[model samples]
Target chain A: MRSQSRIAFYLLLTPLVLWLGLLIVIPHIDMLLISLRERISFGVYDRSLLQYEKALTEPLYLRTFARTAVMSILATAITLIIAFPVAYYIAKMAKGRLQQVLFLLCLIPFYVSELVRTFGWMILLRETGIVSNLLQWTGLADQPVELLYTDATMMVGLVYTSMLFMVVPLVTTLESLDDSVIEAGYDLGGNGFSVLREIIIPHAMPGIVSGCIVVFMLSLGNYLTPTMLGGKDSLWFTEMIYNQFIVRSNWELGAAFGFMLLVLSSVIVWGMLALTGRTLKETMG
Target chain B: MIPTIPTSRAFRLTYGAYVALFFLYLALPLTVVAVFAFNDSQFPSLPWDGFTWAWFFGTERPQIGVFHERGILRAVGTSAFVAGCVAVLSVAVGTTNAFLFNRYEFRGKGLLYVLMLLPLVIPGIVLGISILIFSSTLANGIWDLAQMDIQALRPGLLLVILGQFSFITTIATLVISARLQKFDRTLEEAALNLGADRLTAVRTITLPFLAPAMVGAVVVAFLMSFENFNTTLMLVGSDAPLTIAMFDRLKEGSTPLLNAVSLLLMLGSSLLALLVILFQRRP
Candidate 1:
């Protein structure tokens, strides 16, 4: 029986070991190693930081990287602001069938693929899109105003794509908070704004942090939305990474850029958790 | 719940309006996508020429429907095939990992579990590139040493499968583990003590219990795999999945046939999502 149990244990351990170890861990370590090396000649290499140096020194790369980070942060903030009230209403204010229905509505768009979602945005924002047509119909515009590719358009797409991620976590955390806690704050000479600032926000911090982390990472990593909505001028850092790896076949440089993104996201996630006094286990779990 | 903070009529009206608009914002893009599928125009966009079904059923010129477009149809098949493979593989491994986490108290388990989730945070692009670099390097090394070329290591369907499986399995495990944690272990133990072998007990009792969650995980994994663009984009070869195919076409510019495809995809995903939601509603 002991032997059987041991065998079963090994059976379970095998897949986890191979899946995480072979797929996730080793590849990342290897990417780091590859990023650190500089190819000198045929079948020869030198240990160097050339890739990192290039990423830092190149104006285009540096600008795009900074832009991606800033844009992602902005997107996260916007999504949070937008999602919080909605999540609050769903979790606390709404009741019964309406609550379930509202939550489902939030989720339905997400079930549609990102590509399709982005396409939908494209259709609505293009010169001949529904909005433009509506404008033309209202005689508000003499000509079709092209709105498909712009920074604002990209932001909208990013926020739209990320809304559900923020909402889901926010709703989960908010729903668990007792109504009396908020009521007590209100009863004790607190207004809605004050109560929310103290009681609700504090309770929802973990959800907020998790949601922000996810939205930021997603917005940061997002390739389709920005490229599609922002056009060739998108200058997204991920696009740079793709250009390096696929277009230019510069794996070393691409790996460096990839590592930079990884580190940046990790630091931001760590920063959010630390600032909120939460741990990865609590937030992620 | 009743005697909460004083809510003025104005405030309530404003809040209700906000909720209404928010739902509209959520619904509009997708609604437009679906509505345009029936728009009888060359472009997917506005000023509807008239309502028509050519996007789905037409077979000539720009009006060629998604069904008639061999490339689109083929890509859909590829996407479905990849999703199916990814779903099955991720869920199987996920179930095993769930058991590993839930049943064991091994040293470094916490660390291992954290490592398992590392994929979730790693940007899909980076994940794709890392696997691409590692596998190609490994493949090259093998070729140099053993004079053998490994096609699977190159950017292709196999790598796409591996790339998606890496992260999807984490999600699958999370979903399955949630269900497994609630499972009464004593039922399996009782079966084992009452003359049933351990395997039989697990097969008949534990698995039957886990079926709902497992099914839900499968659907989630499948949809995720299907909709996956970032990682798949990096690893895809000549045969692109539906998302990659749609992306490529969208870059060139879109036609209403793409709308047709989007409508079909939305319907399919809604059905799958409804199934999972219905399953969750079960006790």
Candidate 2:
């Protein structure tokens, strides 16, 4: 009977081990090797840190990587600022039906593709788009502003795209907070601000940290939003990687860039976990 | 436990206004997409150029409607087929994984579990690149001996499905394992004691309990696979998915027809989500 159970366990385990091992682990290992090697001739290669060296030394690659990191951090921060009030309202303040509806409002947009959502922003922020048209009608400017292909536009797109991720985690954490805890703070002559600082922020810290991590990773890795919103001048790192792989066919450089992204995101996530004192299991969801 | 926060009238009013604005921020862009689907304008952009169904259906220019566009339709079909395969394959493997990891204790189990989740944290673009590089290279060595077609193992729908499956299966496992953690072990034990063998115990007890989570996994996995663009872009070669096709068109310049497609995608996904919610709620 024990042997039968053991056989069943190994049998069930086969699919997972095969899938993850072949598809995920092996590929990543191959990528690491590819990232390490330099192509010498048509099919020949030499082992070197040249790929990493080139990526690090090259001004365009390094600059875009930095830019992507900064932009993602800024986007994460802004998303948190925008998401907090709404999450607070839904999780803590709103009544049953209203809360569900408000929550649904946040969720329904996620039903649409990120491509579609970003496309909608293009329609709104383009030179002849909705905002420009409104400005023209109101006589705000003689010429329509070039809202697309601007850094501010990238910021707006990033924040907009990442809002739901931040909000959901915030809502989840905030929903678990006991109302009496906040009321206790309030009853002890604590004003709203004091209660917020004393009770609410502490309770929501794990959510905030986790949400920030998720948003940061997404915004950093995001290719389409920046490319669409910021156009040619987007200067996102993923675009650099894309150019390397497809246009340039420089897989080595692209692999290095991809590895760099993996490292950067992992390091940041680790830092966040350390700072917040939350386990990976606790924070990942 | 969630409701009844202590708040002043001033805070209440302010919070209410902020919430309204926040909802607007979330809903307005989506609303714009839907509204432009009906716009009579040649361009997808705005000033609400009178209402028309030309983008949805019109004889004057058939290609102006997304459904009329051949490339877009082909992509839609490809996306559906790939997503269907991915959903089925991922759920089967993912559910089995959930049970294995949840019910067992073994050497390197913790390490293996962490490794399983690596795909979730990895960027889709990277996943695609890695898988593309890995598979083609692996196939290069094996093809001569195995006498298999290289294109089949190359970057395309098969690679796209594999790339998506890596991360998606992790999600399914997480969702299922969460459900599994809440399950009582005694139910399976109860079946076994009543003369059912191990397989029968599982089929009658464990599998039935996991059905709801498996259903949710199907929808979520299907949507993720369908909506995926990053991994698909890296791995896709000749054949295009809807997101990739639409993005290519948008880059060249698009019409309200793209908006129509966006609206259609929204409607389809919303219906799926609604079905999942209702199905889950049913006793």
Candidate 3:
């Protein structure tokens, strides 16, 4: 019976091992190798960091990388600011059926595909869009303001798209907090700000960290929303990587950029983890 | 029950308005998309010419609606096929892995657990690239090994499935394993003592218990694979899914037909999500 159980265990484990080892781990290794070696001919290459140097040295690539990072950070910060109140109201104020309904209302929009969601934005912000029409109708402007390709719309799209991710985590963490703790602080003459600083924020740190990590990674790696919404001048890093791989057939350069993205996620995730003092497992959940 | 924090009437009123505006922001874009699908105008934007079903059912060559458009119908078919393959492959592997990880103890288990979750952390684009590189190299190695022109194993639908499966399977495993961790183990032990074998015990006892999670995993896997863009963009060779097709249309320029398609996708997914929520809360 023990031998049989052991055999069953091994059988169950083999598929996962093979799936991860062969597909994920080995591919990442291959990507690393491809990134390191510079292609000399159709089938020949040498080990060098020329791709990395080029990514750094090229003004276009460097600007794209910096722009992507800055926009992603701004998106993350803006999402947090916008999401906190709604999350707080749901987790703290709203009760029973109202909370459930509101939470579902927040989540239903997310059910639409990301691409579809972006398409919805495009419909509204195009030259003949309602916003532009409204401006013309109000006599605030005589012509349609082309809002589709601007940074404001880009920020709006990023924040809007990621609101659910931020809110869900914050709600989960905040819901678990004991309200009496806050009441006690209020009763003891502590003002709203102090109570928030001393108790609520401290307790909700893990959720904040997790939500920030997700929003940051999402906005950073986002290709569709930025490219589609930000239009021609978006200079989104992901688009550059996509261009390298598909358009230019520069796999080595693309692989390097992909690795740099990996590095960025790791760094931001690590930084958040460090600041919050949460372990990888805890923060991820 | 916990009492909420105290606030003044002014604060409450402001918060209420803020919440209402938030909901509008969330719901407005999709509302425009849905409404504009039937708009008689040439464009998807405002100043609706009149209401018409042409966007939904156009039968002409260039002004084709979503349904009549052969490329769209074909892409939908392709998306469905890829999603189906991914759902099945991922769920099978995921269910087995979940049970093993949750039930047993072994060497390197901690490391394996982290490694299993590594795919979720990595972006889809990176995974797509990795798989593309790895598979092409693998095809060439096989060619070198056996003087056979077996290099037809490059990018295509199969690569799409495999690339999607890499992460989707991990997600399914996480879902099922979280459920497994909470299940009572003594039921299986009692069944074993009653002379039932492990396989039979698991089939009758554990499988039923895990049915809900398995369903959720399958639905999520299918939907994710269907909607996937970045990875699909990288790995897809000649064939384009609905997302790729829609994106291509977007790049070229959009028509009300695109809005028609978005509205359909929105309705279909919202209905699916509603069903999941209803069933989840059906106790």
Best by lDDT: 1
Candidate 2 lDDT over residue span A80-174, tens digit each: 98899889889987878998988988998888899999998999888888888888889997888768888898888889887888999999999
Over B8-84, each residue of candidate 2 has an lDDT whose tens digit, in order, gives: 77867777788898888888889898998998877877666798888777656643576577788899999999999
What is the full ranking by DockQ, best candidate first? 1, 2, 3
Cα deviation at A277, candidate 2, in Å, is: 1.6
TM-score per candidate: 0.98, 0.97, 0.97
Candidate 1 chain B lowest-lDDT run of ten = B1-10
Candidate with more favorable, higher DockQ: 1 or 3: 1
User: Across residues B130-164, which tens digit of lDDT does each residue of candidate 3 receive?
Assistant: 99999888888888899666544577899999989
Off by over 4 Å in 1: B1-3
Model 3 bad stretches (over 4 Å) = B1-5, B61-63
**Residue B241 lDDT (model 1):** 96
CAPRI rating of model 3: medium
RMSD of each: 1.4, 1.8, 1.7
Higher-scoring candidate on lDDT, 1 or 2:
1
Calculate each model's fnat, 2 decimals. Answer: 0.78, 0.72, 0.67
Candidate 1 TM-score, true structure as reference? 0.98
